[model samples]
Target: MTPTGDELLAMLSALANPLRLRIVAQLAGGRDYVSHLAREIGISRPLLHMHLQRLEAAGLIVGSLELSDDGKAMKYYEVVDFDLHLTASALAEAVRTLPPTDQEKP
Candidate 1:
């Protein structure tokens, strides 16, 4: 289903953070454990988890619980889809809302 404006905004907002973007990019590779992501992204485990929860809520990613060989439970996350699937209008709207770059400043 096509996302509504608010949904789009939430998704965009979730992605606005640099660390979140990195998380999405990493998830695009394949399913990965939260601990692995935290280490790779260089963010504290708690902070990374907070960002991940937001991303999951936005439907940008999904997490599944798994049992490791050691019998420890772990949560692994993966991008819902390989593509971002933003509509043209959404892209245009987002671009319009962006602040002017240095080149655009007088």
Candidate 2:
């Protein structure tokens, strides 16, 4: 899907961080729970949650709360199926849909 200018910007901004990039790379392998993902990525759960929230906001990753066998709650995250084909034409189209900002107005 062609993202709007704001969406494109959000996705780019979300991916611009090294930590977020690592989170995406780790999730690319498979879906994982919060603690496991944190351990694999070598970051604290809270920090990972911040990154995950950004990814989720950008539509790059999705999370779901599930119950473990023992009935404990676990939050799992997985990379969403998304294909972003960025090109000049795509950017132009996206820009056209952008809302006017104060700085953009005369």
lDDT per residue (tens digit) for residues 1-106 in model 1:
4565556777889999999999999888888998989999999999998999999999899999999999999999998873457779867766666667899989
TM-score: which candidate is best?
2
> Where does candidate 1 have its weakest 10-residue lDDT segment?
1-10
| Candidate 1: Cα lDDT at 1 | 49
**Which candidate has the highest lDDT of all?**
2
Clashing residue pairs, candidate 1? none
Our tally of clashes for model 1 stands at: 0
**Model 1, which residues run further than 4 Å from truth?**
82-106
RMSD of 1: 7.3
RMSD of each: 7.3, 1.1
What are the runs in model 2 whose C-alpha is more than 4 Å off? none
**lDDT of the structure predicted as candidate 2:** 0.95
lDDT of each: 0.86, 0.95
Indicate the residue-level lDDT of 101 in model 2.
87
